[model samples]
Target chain A: MDVGELVDRAREGQPRAVARLISLVEDAHPRLREVAAALTPHTGRARVIGLTGPPGVGKSTSTSMLLSALRAEGKRVGVLAIDPSSPFSGGALLGDRIRMTEHATDPGVFIRSMATRGHLGGLSWATPQAVRVLDAAGFDVVLIETVGVGQSEVDVVKLADTTVVLLAPGLGDGIQAAKAGVLEIADVFVVNKADRDGAETVVRDLKQMIAYARREIRGESWRQPIVRTVAARGEGAQDLVKALSEHHDWLVSHGELERRRAERAADEVAAIALRELQARLTDLHGGGHLPAVAKKVVERELDPYAAADELLAALRAGRG
Target chain B: MDVGELVDRAREGQPRAVARLISLVEDAHPRLREVAAALTPHTGRARVIGLTGPPGVGKSTSTSMLLSALRAEGKRVGVLAIDPSSPFSGGALLGDRIRMTEHATDPGVFIRSMATRGHLGGLSWATPQAVRVLDAAGFDVVLIETVGVGQSEVDVVKLADTTVVLLAPGLGDGIQAAKAGVLEIADVFVVNKADRDGAETVVRDLKQMIAYARREIRGESWRQPIVRTVAARGEGAQDLVKALSEHHDWLVSHGELERRRAERAADEVAAIALRELQARLTDLHGGGHLPAVAKKVVERELDPYAAADELLAALRAGRG
Candidate 1:
């Protein structure tokens, strides 16, 4: 399809076209960039909620419940499930989109599972693009469920309008709290599996931890709400949603919401450009341009560093 | 303390000088880029090995053991231990670094415990640059240790020549072998804590899974060796080291060694560029250029897609 037509269909909320368009964008150079340039205007229309936590923490379930609530409000929701995959392997490992039963039949709910796939953040290179797609397509909300937490998942903190971190009970008991990097990134924390015995305790502990964290970060006054949710039963989800609205309000009042979106926008553009340069560099390096240098360095004819410097200089000069 | 003098000292094998100089280069931008360009001739010297696994899987123990054996051969070693920190709070976290005891008073070993405070993948922006410093400082081997078995840790697979995926006795069982992403990236598979009862079972399971993976990925015959190691007691460590050497030879003989290095070099350069752009873009966007557009966006006075288009146009026009 022509780029214009493809964007039009994507804007029309065509899921297959949206997926194909992202594929084309991921594989292309100047055209994908032009597409990004075109889609930027549509980005802020859909409220993006990032759902993240450790694996098996009920993030997926909570996302489902949130999506259901948004749909009930007569809103068109787009679900972007980020999976971790090897670009070398071209796989989206462990996407649980199949588990989102309600959205399968809801035409208004467009669900697309993407992988960082060597894209570096457990998010698709075209994630911001795809979110724009959902936004332009008139989706009321875009819900992103990430594969796991920590560094890669933090990408969502910048990308999303709100980030919900899900934690199960018993997580705060051991050394797990030491590893819970999501505590700070979360706009709202969901103690999922509230039927479990330690739900209240987890909430209490998280509140205290957040309090300590706020004090340490030096004047971070917006308190991250700890919402207890039995996602399996869809309990406390409305409260979670309310917490999201409240957080969004807080961001607006504190002047951080725009700050973050701008940050993400800049990153999105730069990443698109670097990805272009990378693809070109790969072909040159793989075409035996560097092997002779490697052989010479291995033989001590010259050091590897000098050889690399020479190789890059040659590539820059187009003299190799 | 000047860069030139520091470089001189590092070249003369002064570890502290090397570390401090690399820190300066890393902490400063234009200086680091210029110095990195100048020092390009001395890097890619050390054989980099990235060790990753699920938390509490004895990654540090294996690293310490591996460092000892490498030291036994009179090989100088550098261990870069990474702890992932919480993003929101910016609190130091995941301190599994206490498990290592290899570098105390050993001139042959340099251990740096780094926090994944800013960026993820268990490496700081300074990591590759630091590795270059250590390489120039004449460390025979560089060992990078990451905290988790997730996408961020996968960065090691590309950064290191030989990537070891360490698995303990019981965490994330059955599903691990099914993790085609991490499993496929491993050059050496280590079931660390092999004295544990389920060690043999995990190995058997991994072997089967690897066999299936080998068949599935089709061509490009790279054999991944599964080495069972009781890391705490230093049992089977020699065998692990031997397998690493065997893999190295296999990679070289098959010409994969050169290919992989070329790929890593390209990735390293690209990642560096991407990181720089991310920082730059963040600065530019935060500096009051994009807020008017963002305000219009938040108030819904104009749609985001169109606003983004306008923003880009303004960016190109050097006005907003």
Candidate 2:
């Protein structure tokens, strides 16, 4: 488990090495600290783009279309498909890796599906680390595709430099997008399934919502562009590509890119710090202290806040 | 603002005082410590029952019906409806409070809908506190209902003494339920809208799944009963109530009730302790330390793990 050798192989565009490093990240390997330090200097070159929408919106098709479009521009791309494991759908609707077989043998493309199940903090904890692996692996573009605009999906997209929210005709998605706070997080909006009957209505509704949002935001904010896409046929992928490029240019020119990356890094660092502290807390008093304190709280003999104080005090004392 | 006076009025069953106390908990007020301490002594008497299902399953109607049945038994019931603010549906489909107007004027029944939108840790952090408020207010039964079987909903039901997972015919919910791991968490299953077509199919599928699960889990496990009801017509409410009572008896007799409560309290205490530590971490170096560390990570001058270590070390030094 020589992290430097592994990282070196990953940087050389070895697919197996890249996959292994991400697996290490996903498993929270013991040498993760060493791996992170090894990969750090080679990272920060990939541009992250997030695509999200409700079910039945053709998110996977759109992602595959975008990947092809980016590859056509001679850019190496990495696709991280996040399956949030919907309680309603049971799992992701799109068999993304299967749909992406066209690029499977290409050295320039990397595709991985990460399921946010049984992972501590789920998406927020795991997605970024996997993204770091791809970024360090020298991918020019990292596209993160997630199903549904749940809270976790929104958090994942916030890590991207550009977030593209996809909607479609006849899913009642127009009102859902607005109500789900999708307008606030989306840098670019894609009306997928443009070949469908109500595509124009979805686009019009989105336009109105974007216009309303632009007026309310008091700053030099980028006006989100609405692009229509029949992604299944690859009809409007070039337009989506153009929209993404414009957003990325805007981010870099306005210094928003640096600020966003820094903020994302801060969040990542803070989350890791909290997790480390929690692990230590769990290890304290041979891991029996919390359960004992919780017993008293459950018995109504002690309050939760007081119990928390005792746990924190014990943690502090152990640190000494 | 006087914590003791508020707790006193709450225990006296004053609706306004109870509402005020829950609001304090939702807002995470400074006196929450005092409130928890005051409420601790009066807690642990109420039976906490959780009802959850996907949208369009009539969770609100079922909850209203259950409230009436409990009131008929001369029991004061409090309903804590958690709205998880789904990104797919936007908000809860059931205008629960509006639908529960039948019990609005009933002094013996109190209904509250807590939206988990901006609260830190969302449902996990706020629901328990609100439940404590209701329990301390001298309610004999507390019904916690949530729409959708997402992760947060599952976590919320884990706090209950008994969890009822509702499913409706023709929604393809049986497979979804099993896939979503609902079978493991549901202490009881209710097929609402049983008068609809495919009701028998749902019941049959659920029976098979439950039977399979029972075989897998050895020893004194309660077999989850499949209860059918057309909740809109108020049919089978008593049967559902009977099932709940039997489950409660099982829990009490088997000592599982205490075990569940102790586990729930431990989770609550751990969440609070982590939040307290996070607050302290945020308050360090005028809240600028994280941003500084994050900038270094973004510049590839430091890795995230190293940055987390730096943040932890700073917190430890600050504590000393």
Candidate 3:
């Protein structure tokens, strides 16, 4: 519970302290405010990268490969494997973390798996806070890996300085990626399993889509590069790393990094504000207001918008 | 847009009027409040059924078969095929709607495909409003079919009276469903493509999971029946319909139906209220308040929670 001592230990690169800080973020613990306040001054130094794809895309392998590549540069790396779909704290997804344990004894590598556990907004609300913990803990780079390309996953990736979308053949994921709106969010695309058949097709398809997307964009935009990787064998790791560095440079030069970080902060702040207002709304009339208004709305005595107006008025009156 | 007259026409079962009302909902039109007020009285009568599964599980086929079965019973049916992943309105997913055109001409059947078009909350916010339009249009049943088993899809299913989680052989979806927390939301299980090679295995796997889940429940829980169906061949349509009716009866007899509706209404009202608050927050300082607070947070001068507190105070001051 001594947040200052814990943060000091975390800043000294103590993995246990860093893990505890992130757990606080995940649990939405009451002392989270104190932890955030203690960690704020030391944050914003680490570079964040996000990796996401459909299931069976070898996301963990790609993440592990990236961790090794980043480590070769003598940079401390943090991995947050986020499973938005999993309700258990470490269910099924923790099994994927086993593949990552090759770095368990490495002092510079920290990996953690996060599941939603029925969180209000899934893991999006907690992800940035967890990233802040790692960033403040002095990791040179933080990699966020999400399980699926769902809306929540997209939201998580938006917090990254660079987003790498992985895809392979025979999953029909080339079009699936586009359909899920991954194409717009991807800063770099990795065609993993490059040794497999139809890898060329996935690359070609992504190339065409990226070209098409480029024409629609008005201002200066970084063209998303397609990197072919046989990640299981550690093939193409250097190229992927190089591509990531290039995208990071582009983000910085174009001022997109600052803009993205500020936008993420805004989103985080807004979500917290809404959660606070929601808590106050729930507390109104001893939590009876919602159910009462809901009953009236269900019974056709009121519409939802009017019901919302009444609730807002109650909120104002209570504030007064 | 003559919401009163439109509601009257919709009550008379005019499909055009119903379509217009739903279009207004989808557009988030300014007159949506008027439309909702007009439609409120006629809702609360229709049974809303939600069908969802992984892609290529024959969701469209199952929905088509169910539509046929429901129409054979002389019941008016409305279909809302929601593609939350699609960024374009009715893009790519409209192809699936073509297969349901046979029912398109049936005056008793109303079929519509809704794409999110980058809506703030995906299609979850618009779906209930669209369902209200159908309910007020004198539909006896409304079927909501979503593409994937993502978080947004789960949110959509929570609005349904009976939620059917479909799976097929060879998709490895039995475990995927459990991993995605779909097992907890599904009221019924459909092993579509029942004639396929691995159909029995899927049924057995689901049965085992269902039994495992049943043991975890403390109170009166519906034993989610695993129904086998070759939806593509129109087989098991009657069985599916029978199972739905049984679940409906169980819900009503247990008072769970009223409880679920009330919960859904409360969620709807809260979402509207949150959207209003979000708009007001955005309008503060001519939209510069958020970015300024966000910049401060990004610079680590203030933490996000404190930034949220500042925004909330500004909201109150502006209101006063």
Which candidate ranks first by TM-score, i.e. highest?
2
lDDT of 3 by residue, A219-305 (tens): 456788899998899999999999999999998999999999999899888877877787777786366998999999988899999
- Predicted complex 1: CAPRI docking category: incorrect
Q: What is the per-residue lDDT of model 1 for residues A180-247, given as tens digits with 9 covering 90 to 100?
A: 46654677888899899877777777777887777777377678888888998999979987898898
| Cα-based lDDT for every prediction | 0.67, 0.84, 0.83
Candidate 3 at B271: error in angstroms?
A: 1.1
CA RMSD per model (angstroms):
5.0, 2.2, 2.5
> Which ranking of candidates, highest lDDT first?
2, 3, 1
What stretches of model 3 exceed 4 Å from their correct place?
A86-95, A176-180, B86-95, B176-180
> In candidate 2, how many Å is residue B5 off?
1.2
Each candidate's B-chain TM-score, in sequence, is: 0.89, 0.96, 0.94
Q: On residues A117-193, what C-alpha lDDT tens digit does candidate 2 reach at each position? A: 65666677778888999999999999998865356666888889999988888875355435537776788989898
Chain B TM-score in candidate 1, rounded to 2 decimals? 0.89
Number of the candidate with higher DockQ, 1 or 3: 3
TM accuracy, model 3: 0.94
lDDT of 1 at B101: 51
Candidate 2 chain A least-lDDT 10 residues = A88-97
Residue range B1-320, candidate 1, lDDT tens digits: 36677777877878788678656544544566555554556766688888877656787788889999999999999887765543422222233455565457788888886654454213534567677778878889999887554455566545788988887676644335346656656788888888877888888878887888778774667678888888889998899999988988887898877777765654555455445434434454666645665566444454444454555455435521
